[model samples]
Target chain A: MVQLTTDNSYGTWRFCAWNGMIFMGVFIVFWGIMGHNVPPYGGDMDASVIANYFRDNANLVRLGMAISMTFAVSYAVWGISIGKVMDYILGRDHILTNLQVWGAGLTVVPILVSSSFWLTGSYRPEALPDEILQLLYDMAWLLIDLAYSVTSVQMIALGVGCLRDKRAQPFFPKWVCWYSIWVGFMFVAEILMPMFKSGAFARQGILNFWIEFMIFFIYAPIITFYQLKAIKRIEAGEPAA
Target chain B: MSDEQSALQQSGRAPGDPGVWFFIIADMAMFAIFFLIFMAGRHEAPELYRASQAHLDSRFGLANTLILLTSGACMAKAVMMARAGDVAITLRYLLLTLGIGLLFGVSKVMEYGTKFAAGIAINTNEFFGYYFAFTGIHFLHWIIGCGVLTVLIRRVRRSGVNAENINWIESGGIYWHMVDLLWVMLFAMIYLLPPGGTA
Candidate 1:
């Protein structure tokens, strides 16, 4: 049986993990307020139209990216906490655990790189040529949308681990395991975004953008809900056998 | 016999584990979202949707629907037989379910082949996109359901419908029924409904 100690360090990590949803919620508000949400969806305009918006809202864009960066870091922490529980479930180190951590760690890259690009575009939109600004904007969206495979890998790892749990009361319920797998499968649709400029498969399309975002938003909360419960069980001295 | 009855009584509370229901409910909700999105798209382009819908063969959809419904019936019979400790009969029903499921799969492939021959594809239009996306996903579920049926058949054959194995058999049957239910909706929405009407 695997048991976790109810100590200060573990307590703090668990607390951080539980608050992962807050970080994401705040990030969404900031991003929306800064007007970065709409332009990328193609619901509003092309890159040229958005370049002007970025040029005008430079300071807001910079602030949004900085705040989003914090959320990215928080997400990594949450991922680590999930990996820890998964490790306990397996009772030993496993490649899936490593994949979860690695995938979570690499997820930060896209957010960081995308935010940096947006920041650069907004930093001196006046100094940079319009085409250059447009290029930067497109690059940011591509990284954010297409780089979803990293998160998919993380989902796959956690899902597989959960399904493999053989305990009477598994650390994660079987449904959550299937949900994780389904969410990971849904991200495969992101690959179609670059090929379509409009319609459901496009970046701004309902399936790819709206439904995908809704799923992503719902995913964090569900995982955090289950993860917090699992942590509480561990803290209460429940064995992983 | 009492033991078997008790097992059946237990399985009666839920066809599968609570977790399986959770997955099914969530999956249905997601499909509902897809339906809503597809409907909204149709509203935006009624004529285009109608033209695209015309390209789909309703008979193929009807055929697949009948196949799945038959398979689902066999699945139900198999579960009943398993609960009665009739392993041989249950195996027969399971095999019948598997065969009908394969027929459904074959019908789907033929439908897709015809569409491809006509140069229709997922990206050809909004209607085609929804057609392929919705049916394509349901098709994946069918494939999974077939696999589950295969496992259940093997388990019943090996264990002969013991108390321990009954729960799994019931779970797989429930999952197959869900696949069938979803197809009924898909068949009606994608094939039977008028292009401008709601599913």
Candidate 2:
């Protein structure tokens, strides 16, 4: 059994665990709130309307997207931390653990790339044509929504790994494991997003944006809570391997 | 029998892992939301929705419903037989369930073909959009359930039902039932419920 306590990396592990919350907070405030994407502009909104909003709020959008792009790395770092814990539960070379980290790492690409598109649109919204700005905005949403499977894989990998833990007391409870998988599966609804522009399947609509994204937000906090507890247990000299 | 297996036999205990229950409840809640959205859409353009919905062949939906229900019954029997250590009977029922599940998929594909042949599609109108989205999502669930059943069949074939493996069988059954339950609700809302009637 590996002695997790004397490993000298617990402090870093704990800090990385905290990154999950930090990523959620910064991403929500800057990417979601300040960027005016909490519900996002409607997919069916006219180009002029979308361009006008960006042009009108150029500075705020630039600030939000720029900061969002930077902090998005925190999500990957958080994944590494979770993957480390999973490594202890499974082996370091375990397929699921590798998948968990890889998924988390790849998930950053779309978020960062999408944020760049939004940032570029807002970079000089005054100089750009309405259609050009609208194209950038639509591209961003498409990239973000369509690339959701990576994050879903991360969630499922984590959930399945935790469920496989046969310790006397598992790292995460059964409900959280299943809930993580459920939230991951729920992202399938986003596949319909590009098809509908006005109804519930639209990017800004109720089901796609509100319910789908909200559950993810809820899932993050729950997983973080359990992870923090699991870290403490390991530090207290529980055998991780 | 192990304590876990003994507890499984108790009347008050739920079948499968508690985690699966969480999934089942969460899944039902999402479908509930989907149903609500469908109702809200139908309310916005009752005439259009009613007209589009009228084009659907209720017979197709009815046939799929019966097929899924039979599959669900077979899965339940499989779970029971597995618990009773009747590995041969369990495999038979599991195979039956898988066959019925395939029938549901085939029927759905044929129904989609009919719509396409008639110039109706997912993007035809608001009603068709909801129809395709709802049924499509449910179809994915059924496909996954079939996969789960396949695994259980393989497990029983290899080692039969032991204390360690029975929970997996029960959990797989629970998932299959959920697929059936969701379809029944889908059938009623999309097929049986006529426009301007609430019961």
Candidate 1: tens digits of C-alpha lDDT, residues A1-241: 5543334366875877775686678667766557467536373356667678777788898898878776777778888888778866875567887888788788888988988888888888888777788788778878888999999999988887887788788888888887887787678667767656687777788778888888888888988888888878777766765
TM-scores for all candidates: the values are 0.82, 0.96
- What does candidate 1's lDDT look like per residue over B1-199, in tens digits? 5575586577677655656676678778878887888878878888888888888899999899899999999998888888788989999999999998999989999999999999998778778877887888888888888888888888887888997677788878888988999999988877877866644
Best by DockQ: 2
lDDT of 2 at A142: 91
Tens-digit lDDT track for model 2 on A1-241? 5323234488898899888888889889999988989888998889999999899888999999999899899889999888878877886668898888998899999999999999999998899999999999999999999898999999999999889888878989989999988988989999998898888999998989999889978877898898988888877777775
iRMSD (1 decimal) for each model: 2.3, 0.6
Model 2 chain B weakest 10-residue run by lDDT: B2-11
Q: What lDDT score goes with residue A98 in model 2?
A: 86
What TM-score quantifies how close candidate 2 is to the native fold? 0.96
Task: Compute the lDDT for candidate 1.
Answer: 0.80
DockQ in order:
0.34, 0.88
